[model samples]
Target chain A: MAAAFTAIGGKWKLTLLYWLAHGESHFAGLRRRGAPITPKVLAEQLRELEADGLVERVVTGPVPARVIYRLTPYGATVLPVVEGVRVWGEAHLQRTDGQSVSDTAMSCASSIV
Target chain B: MAAAFTAIGGKWKLTLLYWLAHGESHFAGLRRRGAPITPKVLAEQLRELEADGLVERVVTGPVPARVIYRLTPYGATVLPVVEGVRVWGEAHLQRTDGQSVSDTAMSCASSIV
Candidate 1:
């Protein structure tokens, strides 16, 4: 359980992975997707995920290069878990009063299952 | 996503719920199950879970009353999510070098589904 939590335990790790499930995103794109996450924390979480082999960071172009983040093939293995969390979150939000995943991520997560 | 994480997020909420899935336990018992959790944090987490309606605290006896913590019927709703985390953790542990859930919780969690 700790391992699972460690891999995706933080507030933003799963959310980041959820966003990546749609396709790769540049650092700014991901930052925009989860607007509340600070750049420092986002970079840290992305680094941790990359270390865990669930996310990969790629550099595109030369100077003023764009950094892309995407799920690795090994990372794909965690999609089911991500979907479970997303679906549960959506349902819980409906039951209680809370913010929810965006429609795009919601539909994409549902379809992935 | 925020709602779901709020309900069972944190390092210990899901684990607390996972232990309770076996049966109700008192403060000491819960402490024993999760040895590393500080008393203050355990109380706080239990209080939060109770406040969220996922866990219930029953007082048995008077004078040095026994406090038993158990999952509310609604709390059972989060079991699938907990199970997903546990199963994923187990698999991730096998693949990586990480701690695994105790045999008791592992077998019980497996039997739950």
Candidate 2:
């Protein structure tokens, strides 16, 4: 359990996975979707996810390279857990603050199985 | 999402919650169930959980005193997420290491809704 947490426990990693699972695969797409994560931090977290075998990085083209990240099969297995977090967070926000879960948050929660 | 992770992201917090959800509510029971977490660390994590409104601490009896920890209604919402983690971890262990998820691990995953 601890090992699993260490692999995907970053503040932005799960959110990144949430976006990727919804078809945001390219680097720029992920960065734009993950707005609060600065470019440097996003790069670092992606590197960590790649190292942990949860994400695969692909490079294409000649002069200007395009990099894309996709979940490994192993990584896809984490979607349920991410959904769990999203569900819990939505309930938590509603319970504690009397506010509806945000559209982005709801989308992330509803995107996976 | 980031705030949610910060509240429950400790290595032992979710595992501790798993035990509590299964009815091991006393401090000593939690300690025994959470074998990998040292007493000091358990105390620290429990403190954090209490502060986050996920746990409630109760003291009963006159002589010797008994302290029990249980999930708040708010805290109970997180059980599904923990279940999700347990499922993912079991599948992850099997896929990567060709081994079953430990008994303790499965119980943690199974105890909650």
Candidate 3:
């Protein structure tokens, strides 16, 4: 469980996964979708995800390479988990009027997941 | 999502919740189940969970009060999510022969969830 968490437990990784799961596979697309994460942090997180086999990065073209990221089959397994969290967050927001679990990272969880 | 993660993201929190979800509600029971976590750390994580409304702490008896912990209704919502992660971890263990995602915390995720 903690391994699952360690593999996908960051503030931005799940948000990034949420977007990629929705077909936003390009690096630029992920950056735009993952607004709060600076490029450096995003890059680092992606690297970690790739290492964990949850994400794959592909580069295309001879020049001005177009980098793309997609969830591996293994990575896609997390979709249901993320969806569950999103649903729970929506209900929590409604019940609490968005007052509890005040971490800023949760704001992203609420928005993206 | 991050808030949900932050609320329950630690190495010990979900593991503790997993035991409580299974009816191991007393402090001693949790400590025995959560062997790797020192008593001090377990206390801290439970306190955080209680503060987040995920776990309720109850006191019973007159002197040498017997304290108990159980998931709030809100916390119970996370059970399916934890179950999902557990399934994933089991498959992951089978696939990798238990070599990857080797953090000690993951050991707990694997056992408890």
Maximum-DockQ candidate: 1
Better lDDT candidate (2, 3): 2
Report the C-alpha displacement of residue A49, candidate 1, in angstroms.
Answer: 1.9
What is the CA-based DockQ of model 1?
Answer: 0.38
Taking the tens digit of each residue's C-alpha lDDT, what string does model 1 give over B30-105?
7665346799988998998898788999988775647799999988988888788778766776687555545443
The candidates, ranked best first by DockQ, are 1, 3, 2
TM-score of chain A of 1: 0.83
| lDDT (Cα, tens digit) per residue for candidate 2, span B12-74 | 777777777766377777766535668888899899889878999988756453888889887
TM-score of chain A of each: 0.83, 0.81, 0.76
lDDT of 2 at B35: 55
| Residue A111 in model 1: lDDT | 37
What's the candidate order when arranged by decreasing lDDT?
Answer: 1, 2, 3
Off by over 4 Å in 2: A1-12, A24-48, A61-66, A98-110, B1-12, B24-48, B61-66, B98-113
Q: Write the per-residue lDDT of candidate 3 for residues A1-113, one digit (tens) a residue.
A: 34444566554666667667766377666665425668888888899778878899987655453778888888888787767656665565656564454444334344433
- State the DockQ of every prediction: 0.38, 0.22, 0.31
Candidate 3's C-alpha runs over 4 A off are: A1-6, A9-12, A25-44, A61-66, A99-113, B1-13, B24-48, B59-68, B99-113
Candidate RMSDs in order: 3.6, 4.7, 5.4
**Each model's TM-score?**
0.78, 0.66, 0.65
